[model samples]
Target chain A: MIADYGYVGLFLVFGIIFVAGALAVSWFLRPRAPSPEKNSCYECGEVIKGGSWIQFNVRYYLIALIFVVFDVEILFLIPWAVIFRELGFVAFVEMVVFIGVLIAGLVYAWKKGALEWQ
Target chain B: MIIPVLTLIIMLIVGAVVLGFIAVSAMFLIWWERKVSAHIQTRYGPMRVGWHGALQSVADVIKLLLKENITPSGVDRLSWWLAPFFAVVPVVMVFVCIPFGNIFGIELIARDLNIGILYIMALTSICVLGIFMAGWGSNNKYSLLGGMRSAAQIVSYEIPLVLAMVTAVMFAGSLSMQKIVEAQKGLWFVFQPNMAIAFAIFIIAGTAEVNRTPFDIPEAESELVAGFHTEYSGMKFAMFFLGEYTNMFVISALAATLFLGGWSGPFLPPVIWFLIKTYGLVTFMMWIRWTLPRVRVDQLMGFAWKVLTPVSFANLIVAGWILMK
Candidate 1:
């Protein structure tokens, strides 16, 4: 196990070195050329406009909120599903309850207009 | 003295073969992507050169090599160029854990580590960081946005991806790829009722992780115009291209090794079976890429966090309870 992790670590180091080396080589080999027009933000060659970093919609946050609820539920379900045959009726009952909780969240999202698109 | 020299020679030859395979496979996959996409859209793809454009990628490579390397002013020169190398190296490293055949057979794998799954997972994460660097270093706003999107997408999807794998690990009771493959000798994990759910989650998460279609908001060509690598040109761009294709191969191979019974089949060599299964998965990925419309960013995150996460978690609990009993 230790050796396995070590190999992964070695690979990471190699990755860093390779990337760093390439950048260094390119910096030296490539010619340096800078102009205001060249450095300007590219937007179909139109003249420069306002800042490009405005805040996006809040719906994205709502979607993330809904996702959190569901994602956790899925994590809880995988192991249960794996051993379902062995666990019998009792396990099934527990899973039903779990799914019930998830369904409630989905229903809640659906009702709250969270799932609707403009 | 002879034995040591012979061992050294063998090691060099093996390394060369592996590197050669990585390069050739990546090139072929690039060509295949263009051809497949062309056919899907009702157009002829690269039929001019080397029998139905087999050498088209080769021609493209030469062009990229001959093209002048451009460096934009005010960009972080070092990081801008380093990005591509960072993207490709981890992909090459992932092949080490893949078991192509049995011990008595070719066993084309580079290394078999006990924590193979985790190792690949960790290495793949570095690719994200590379993109991040590329975006920020390029001094371009579009590239920065693309990089940020990639980072967010990767972070969100990675959780479910790992969770899905946990289900397999819990069932197989091992983290080693070879051990995982061996566990499926009698029955592949995909056929298991509970494992089926996990497998589905894995496929979806894998697609997002590699930034492939519908989930490809990071590099949305229509929107970002090539995303984080927008400023790159020539051979540097090719490296990123190679990296992306290699990543696709890694994810497909991983899916095969984990759920489809890696290197286990009758009437064929294990390596051939493994490749066939892997390529099959790859082709499916390509199909999805061409068929589905690119999803909006909000929808992408919603699917990951809301749908996939909850389903995978529920699957996990069910797996745990079953194991307990």
Candidate 2:
């Protein structure tokens, strides 16, 4: 098991190396001519307006918040699901209850308009 | 000392093989997708490059590598420079857990971690961060919108994706990819009625997870000018392209392993079976990408949160109840 994790670490290192190596090779071969117009931010060929740091839609943030709640619920569900057969009827019922509560929460969120895009 | 040195050498070779596989697989998928999309539109895609444009992706890679590396002014140097690496590396890391079946009596996976599915899910989630970074770092309005949309879409669909996967885990009773495959040796999970729904949910949410059409609003070409990657050029853009196709492969491979029975078939080799199922799913995704129109952002979010999420949850409960009984 420990050695298996070692391979994972090795792969992580390998992944970084692969990306870095590709970039390095490209750098050595690629051109570096940077003109003012070329380096400016893209705005569909029009003159650059103000910066792109304006306020974003709150719906994105709202969706993320709801996702976090359901994601956490999923984190709990995975372990229970793996051991469901062994744990028998009681654990199954318990998980069903847990999931039911979360579903209610989802429904509540829906009714509250958290899921609506507009 | 001898053992440690031997292990180091083995690790090095495995790393190189995996790296080569990632590069080659991404290139092949890109070429395959072009051919698929072109045929759907009644046109020859890139017949000039090689026999039926087989070498088109290779030429494209060479061109991208040789092009100018443009760093737009007022961009965040750290995030901008690091975004491509961030995009490519996590997808690369996912190869560590993929079970490619045994060949010549040798198991071909890198490491079949006990938490294989969990590990993959976590790594894929991290991909959103890289995309968001690219959007923010570029200082381009379209990029930011693309990044934000990508983030929101991935997170929303992930609920159904995970729930659907959990249904499979429930049936398999193990999180390891190899164990899951072993459990399906007798009868693949997709054949069961409830598991069929689980499989459908997995595929649907998975298509969304990878940002393919009609869920590809994040990088909608017409709307966002390539979305979060609009400002990327040269090798950086190539990295993003590689990451996208590699992500598609990972999703397809996972679907194959969980539902279609990974590497288990009659007569032919296990690796061949695995590739056939995975590439079949990939081709399906490409076909859908070309055939369907992109959805409105509101419609996309509402569909994930409203329809897919609830159906998956109901399916999970029904599956759990049936299994318990």
Measured by TM-score, the strongest candidate is 2
Per residue, candidate 2 scores C-alpha lDDT tens digits across B1-325 of: 9998998899889889989999999999999998988899999898999899999999999999899989999998899988998899999889998999989998999888999999998999999999999999999999999999999999999999998899999999999999999999999999998889989989888999889999999999998999999999989999999999999999999999999898898898999999999999999999889999999989999999889998998898889889987
Cα lDDT for residue A25, candidate 2 = 96
Worst 10 residues of 2 chain B by lDDT: B316-325
- lDDT by residue (tens digit), candidate 2, A1-118: 8778898889889888888988899999998889999999999899899999889988778888889999999999999999888899999889888888988988998899988876
Q: Score the docking of each candidate (DockQ).
A: 0.18, 0.89
Please list the C-alpha lDDT of all candidates, in the order they appear: 0.77, 0.92
Question: What TM-score does candidate 2 get on C-alpha atoms?
Answer: 0.99
The candidate that achieves the highest lDDT relative to the unseen native structure = 2
Task: Show model 1 residue runs off by greater than 4 Å.
Answer: A1-41, A47-118, B1-12
Give candidates' CA RMSD values in order.
4.8, 0.9
How does the DockQ of candidate 1 come out?
0.18
Candidate 1 C-alpha error for residue B85, in Å:
2.7
Instruction: Grade the docking of candidate 1.
Output: incorrect
Candidate 2, position B248, lDDT: 96
